[model samples]
Target: MRDTVIYAHRGLNHAAPENTLAAFAAASRSGVTWIETDTDILADGTAVIMHDSRTDRTTNRSGSIYDLTTSDLDTIDAGSWFSGDFVGERVPTLRELVSFLGPHDLNLNLELKGNTQGRDRSIRLVETVLEELRRLRPGTRVLISSFSPLLLAEVHRRTDAYELAWLVDKGTIGEDWRSVMELCGATALHPSTAVVSNRCVVEEIRRAGFGVNVWTVNSVQEANKLVNWGCTGIITDIADQMVEAGRRR
Candidate 1:
C-alpha cells in the first residue's frame, strides 16, 4: 500500500497545469508526502510526463504528444494556458522529473501510457524507465500501472516488478476483473471517480487483499466519504488539503 500516504494527482493539479514541473514542485513544497503522475514516450522514444494523447487541455497547442520529439516538446507552452506567469514552461521528460523529485523520498505512482504497439517496445520502454530509477542517488518507492493489460503483462514478465495496478476509467470490470488484474500481479485497483458507486466496491478490492486508491478526488467531502469507507489512499488534485482532511478525522 506504499505507506497509505497521500499522492498528489499530477502534483497540485488543481492549482497548476497537470503534469508540469512547476506543479510537481509546488506539491512538494505544499507538504504532500507522495505524488503520482503519467508517463508517455515521445516519437523518439523519450519518456515524457503527460496525461493526455493530445496536448489540447493542458498546453497552448493541439497535437499528439507522441508526434513530438523531446526537443520539439520543449517548444510547446505547457504552462501559459494555466496562467501567463508560466508561459514558457517546457514539458518534462520522465527521467528529468525523476532526477528532480527522486531524492525527496516521495512515493511515486507511474501510469504507463499504453501506446507502444509491440510487446518489445512496451517492455523496452518500461525497462528504460526503471533503469533510470535504478540510477537515482536514492532508491525510489515506485509502482507501475497501465490501462492496457498487454502492457501490464509485458512489465510483469520482464523485470523486478513493483506493485502493478490496473487503471480503469469506466469501471468496466470487463470480462473477468479479478482474472485480468491477477494476471498482471496487481496489488491495487485504480478505478475512476465515478465508480465510487457503493462502499462495497472499495471493500471488495481491499478484502481481496489489494490496496484501493481512487484518482482525482478534490472536494474534502468527496475525499472524506471514500476514506470513511476504508480506502487505502487517494490521488487528488488538492493534495495538501486532502491529506489534512484525512488526518483531521
Candidate 2:
C-alpha cells in the first residue's frame, strides 16, 4: 500500500464531539497531519463546523444550525448527546480551528455546506470563510471541498491558492466530474467510497493526476481493502483504527 495521508473525518468525531475543539484536539494529539470538517454559516455569519443542516443529531437541540447565532449555539450542549463526559461542548469557528491547529503542520480539509437559503447565501458564506482563512493564515495548505458542484466551482473561482476538491457521488464521472472540476479549477477529487466502486476507477483517477480522498469508511477490513485499492488519502471517523488496519498488512 502507498504511504497515503490519513485525515480524521470531522476531527476524530467517532470518538469525540464532532466539530468541537475536543474533536480537533484529539485528532492533533493522535498525530494526524490533517483533519477534515464540514462548515456552515450561523445566523450572525460566523463560520462553524458541522455536517448536518441541523444540530439535533449531534447536539442536544433541534432546528437548523444556521438558524442560531454563535452565542445561541454556545448555549446548547453539543457534546452530551454523544456521551456525558463530553457535555457542554460548543461548536467551533474556522478561526478557533486555525488557532487550535497553528502549532502543528496540520492541513485543513474544509467542506463548504451549501443547500441553504436562496439569497446568494452559499457564495456569500463561502467568500466570508475564504476571507477569514486567507487573513488568518496566508499560503495555508487549506483544501476546500463541497458536494455541490456549483458551489465548489464558485469557491475555486473566487480563490486561486486554496486547493479545491470536487466531491462526486455514484454515477457522476467523466463529463460531469471533469467539467465541474475544470470550471472550478480544482486540483483534486473527493469521491464517496460508494462511487469509486473498483480498482480501475481508482487507478484511472490517480493516473490522470488528480488527488483522490475517500470518505466516512468505518470498518477495519473494509478500510484496509479500500486503501489497497489506492486512494491518495482516506478520511475516516474510525481513523486510528483504520490507519492501524492499513499498517497491519
Evaluate model 1: give its lDDT.
0.78
Weakest lDDT window of 10 consecutive positions for candidate 1: 131-140
Q: Which candidate has the highest lDDT of all?
A: 2
Q: Model 2, 1-249: lDDT tens per residue?
A: 238778788888877988888887888777777889988888778888888989789888899877888778658888998888897898777778877677765778998887577556786688778877865455447888887777877776676877888877786655566666777777889888887789998888888778888876777666667778878878888777656655665
State how far residue 139 of model 2 sits from its true place (Å): 6.9
Instruction: Residues 12-111, candidate 1: write the lDDT tens digits.
Output: 8777777888888888887786789988777788888998878898888898876888788767899988888788887888888888776555667888
* Candidate 2 regions with alpha-carbon error over 4 angstroms: 137-140, 171-175, 245-249
> How many clashes would you count in candidate 1?
0
Model 2 TM:
0.91
Candidates in order have lDDT scores of 0.78, 0.79
